[model samples]
Target: MVDFGEILTTVGDFGFFQKLIILALAFQNVLFPIFFCSFLFIQSDPERHCNTDWILQADSNLTTDEQLNLTLPREEDGTFSRCQMFVPVEWDIGAIREYGLNETTGCRDGWVYYDTLYDATIVTDFDLVCDRSNLAEVVKTIFMAGLLAGSFIFGPTAESYGRRRTTQLPVVLLLIFITVAGVSPNVYVYMVSQFIVGAALGGYRINSTVLEWIGVTKRSLASCMSQMFSSVGQCVMAGLVYAIRDWRRVQYVLAGWQAFIFLWTPESARWLLGQGRTEEANKLIRRVAAINKKKIPENLLDVTGEQEVQTHSGNLVAHLSKYMSFICVLVILRFSLNLGYFCLILNVGKLGLNIFLVQFLFGITEAPAHFLCVWVLELIGRKKSLISSLLAGSFFCLLTLAFPQGEFHVIRAVVITALVTTGKLFLNWGGSVCMVYIQELFPTSVRQTAVGFGSIAYRGAGLLSPLLNILAVYHWSIPIIVYSSLTLTSGALSFLLPETRRKELPDSTHESNTCNNCI
Candidate 1:
């Protein structure tokens, strides 16, 4: 009979070839976040402002429906319908100018050619202020809600099928959904497509598994590198958004890039070996050896032996029993962090600053933060790093709340901007640590389910962020205060988690040294 336990143990201890495969898998992690951040551009309401001038110049004698049909582009089906676009005459140029249109060069002069009934008067009377409560905002929220659902779904599936399959599958699906989302005939299609894309992209979790597969000496460096890719993704997303302002074109570009990832990426050898597919695993390992120009050990084939075959088993209930308590704390922290993060990013215009500048600065700041996290996580340990970040982020979130209502525009801008951006560093770092920790906690049998359940908490919070933003308008400081409190509490809960630095991962309940009641 095959000694399944022995094979699993050998495979669990990764070699140079396996490590390289894990690193390659990490690239998918980078791409997933880039696709995720691009969502901000897709959900943008700026297009509404672009058409403001045209809507105001429509014939005054025309009915509202007639005016809408005259101003908006014909639908893909060749129909003039209000349902085709989310923004209507309510966002016309006259309204935008009234609220304070900054630059007024695009829709001037010859662009306005109309008869007497549809006079081409320069509309300076309409309000420039965008309504926060609108279809655009609602669609954005729904898209994020899909991200929440996707995260949970992907985490478990990745664990069950193997990291490479779970990690790369989403990239393919994201490409398709993003393309569909971009070319969507109307806002309704756009909203649905964005949600599906969010779900597809949310399946990536290779960073955590990659960290676990490498040597302890390499863990911090590897973790840092993984985070750096996310920052790179952010910068890339910004550049892509700028290059392709048309939302659909942006989708097509991202989709095209994602499709390329499958060409170079490989499966996780550890996962394959765990399933007792040594020959297949060896083939993959040899491919890595070939690429890196290293010789594969002939003994590696014998290493699989006659052990390590075991049926993986886990469900939602089993997942909860393992880490429900810890997961709960993370959920609360994620919800608050996401609420604050999205609230600030989504409403950057409300802060009276250049939106593009704010986003660019935010992306630029992440480079240093990623490096800092690498340094801090190794020195203080994962629990301390997580707690300290949460506390710092909470403090800054609180400061933003205390600043006077209408004083020191520049100072408030600098202070609030610093607080939120710095807070993002902590959130991102802590989140990375959480991903690593969750994967380490469970055995391969239930790892996917555990990861999936934990992801639910993270995504669930994301779903609620848009609604929270709406509330922030009426009570600006409420979200800040709430998020700050949640961070502090999650930090305190960190004390309950066992520190797992430099420990060999446990293979079964017998070898497991889990902290009792730690969850």
Candidate 2:
């Protein structure tokens, strides 16, 4: 009898072809953030313009040349006339003038009109006063909540239905929500769409499955490549935001791009093989081999399952009994890292930096950080590397708190940005290490459930970070302190974890039991 499981496992392992797919799958992650973050540019309040009613008034009488002379160099000449423009005449100019608006070159000469959109009685501030007040934060919160929900859903679904179906399911759903979100008529509709997008994103099971398919030797490289792709997504997102200034339009573009991904992407052969569908698995493998211009191994094509047993058969209680502790640690660490990283990224304007430029710089810095992680993982090993990075991040968070506001804003910005970026690098590395660690720690009977439980921490953190930011308004250092403490604690706890450097992945209960220290 052929040992089909062994052959499938060996053939499905990572190779040059698998690397290509991992790279391709990365495009969606990259695009998702780009589309999502683009909204920041439109909704930004760097100059606190959210409540301002500055209508560019064109002078109908003035010729084009005259209009050009009055306007600043940056304003588009076609839209406004040379004439003075003001908000509704009823607005209180007394307060505006008190702020030195009347003394300014633009305000005094009637070249620019500035009016406060806030009415103490009517309530005009959309983010703070209206139904959608703090809509951006709400969107982020809900999106992450959906991810938590999706993470649970994807694990079993992928294990049961195969990785291909589970992976493709989210991509389709992402496309749908992205389209709807782009043209959302109101904040409610937009938030709802974003929630769905987050849910769909949660369903994706490709990263782990893809890594599983590769050889152990290539796993770290493949995982690193995955993080690199996420950075690429950030960079791509930056460019897209620059092109599509409108928040809704950017969402539409992202949705459309996700839809395009279905064209060439393939399902995981390892998943099919695991499900006792060798023929189907071989078919998918052949397709990959074709793309890479390599011949499919004859023995791989003849693979068969060793046994037929129902894999994912249990409830929350059963999963908890097996892997709750592991899940808790992962969730706690992921949440802390995400809280600090995202709060830093999403609240760029609050830091008093050029929002776009800062985001651009953040994305650019990831490249070096990623490369450094690859190098560090090799030189220092995963435990020390992750701990050091988290410690450094905590230190920088303290530095950010210690700096006096306003005097050295630029220097503060650079240090915080660099530290945060570096921290993210370590976080990514730690996450990958944890993923492998958890798989080895759990029994195959409950592996997916265990991983899902761990992922909840990640999604849960995403949901909470935005709320933390909102609270940071009152005490900015609170969130940082919380994040710093959590990271330092997680780093220390990691020391207790047995190092799995260069060990073969554990499969059976006996193997897992023997490697308890590593777990």
Candidate 3:
């Protein structure tokens, strides 16, 4: 039987039809950041101080600044304490300045945020400051836990149900949860809503699975182009937040825009074909050809499209049982790469740039990293590329040690931004190479399973990386040192996998010298 890939070539691999789908699906990638890092904009801990309502009521004649100095306690650096206040007293209101007190207590009445960039946030609304601030991280961790569960659950569900059904269910749930989150009355409600949205992420592929219709040669190009769109979405996210300053409004506006942006997106034709629903797949294919102003020869599709698409239900389990050594290497390497990746991602707020601009620049750097990996893979092949990228990223991270984090703001921002961004660049390439190398290392039947297995370890790193970054409180360089060490070790582990450069895709494990060499 002529495979779907052969049929896709005849219909035009990277034609206008695919472009329309890419355009529609790209918005989904853009919309993801609005939820994923919505915490950054919605829960940001702006400069805050204890609310001095008692003092303000005592005297309206005094200016705001004067009342702040008289009522609030100061730290050693003379900055007003965010979590503490001078004990409320019945001192003579006029001569209160003369009765200066050294003893302080926790913010009894609650805290107030400056609300510079955001009009309101969880920090200001719930008074998640000082002692209560750990709850904010709790909420974020809960959301991540939900994401981890969703990633595991959705892969199997997508195989059982049609891709369209999987997508439709999640998109609807995500919209509802996002709206609920926007209008949530309390932190618990908001976090639960965020968890639901995170769960819906498993169903959203951003059209990566759809590109499987294209042949291998064109599939790589299509994948790269699709990923670039994801980067474009992230690059523009900060501007989106800045323009829509209120977090709730940002959620509402993005939800409404997503409703329209995805209107043109249809179901995946490849998925339909995989389900052995040829009639439906053919209908979609004809519509695609019409949109692209091209024609599929009647005889060509008639001959090939009539075949039933059989799926191997045991493929994943079979691979898992057989490939212990390969799975081990992938899991460890993936965990290390992800640990470094998220360490940088979660700690960006401490990195000294405007959070909005930092997020945008973070997105801007991603697209080129893919191109760089492709270039390096050509130059050095997959194993060496992975090794060099990881080691080199470690070097950049170590360079961050030179700058004293807090004292040299202007200099640290300039120098560390360059170093961290470069480090992320190399780690990102290492990640890309891992994916490419895994596919090459495994036979077709088990490739997806291997990736899924690796992802479990990777997800663990995502959850753990943020907590590891808590070390920043003790010393800013500690997280960087940890990330550097992991990268170095993961790169060393890359030596275990066989080189696949200039080699054809092996059809079976017997033709695979990779596992044998490692053994």
Best by TM-score: 3
- What is the clash tally of candidate 2? 15
Candidate 2: tens digits of C-alpha lDDT, residues 1-519: 343234434444555667667667655566645645633554322221221123123224555444343332222654433222333233343443343222112222322212432111001212322223456566667777888888878876655665567777787787787888766656677668877777787666333334545555555566566566677676776676666545566666776677677333565554454456657766776665565566655764542433322332345365455555556666676667666666666675555565566667667767567666666666666667767766776666666677545664677767766665566555555665565556545554455666676667777777787877777667767877777788778877776666555555543344456545344
User: In model 3, which regions exceed 4 Å deviation?
Assistant: 41-45, 54-81, 86-105, 115-117, 205-210, 263-316, 319-327, 371-384, 402-406, 435-451, 495-519
Across 141-213, the per-residue lDDT of candidate 3 in tens digits comes to: 7776666666576645555564456656777787788889888888899889888887776446411334444
Q: Write down the TM-score of every candidate.
A: 0.74, 0.76, 0.81
Displacement of residue 15 (Cα, Å) in model 3 is 2.4
**What value does the lDDT take at residue 313 in candidate 2?**
34
- Pairing residues by index, what is the TM-score of model 2? 0.76
Stretch of 10 with least lDDT, candidate 1: 116-125
In candidate 3 the C-alpha lDDT for residue 208 amounts to: 32
Off by over 4 Å in 1: 1-23, 28-133, 205-209, 276-307, 310-325, 513-519
**Lowest summed lDDT over 10 consecutive residues: which window, candidate 2?**
117-126
What does the lDDT come to for candidate 3?
0.69
Write down the worst ten-residue block by lDDT for model 3.
205-214
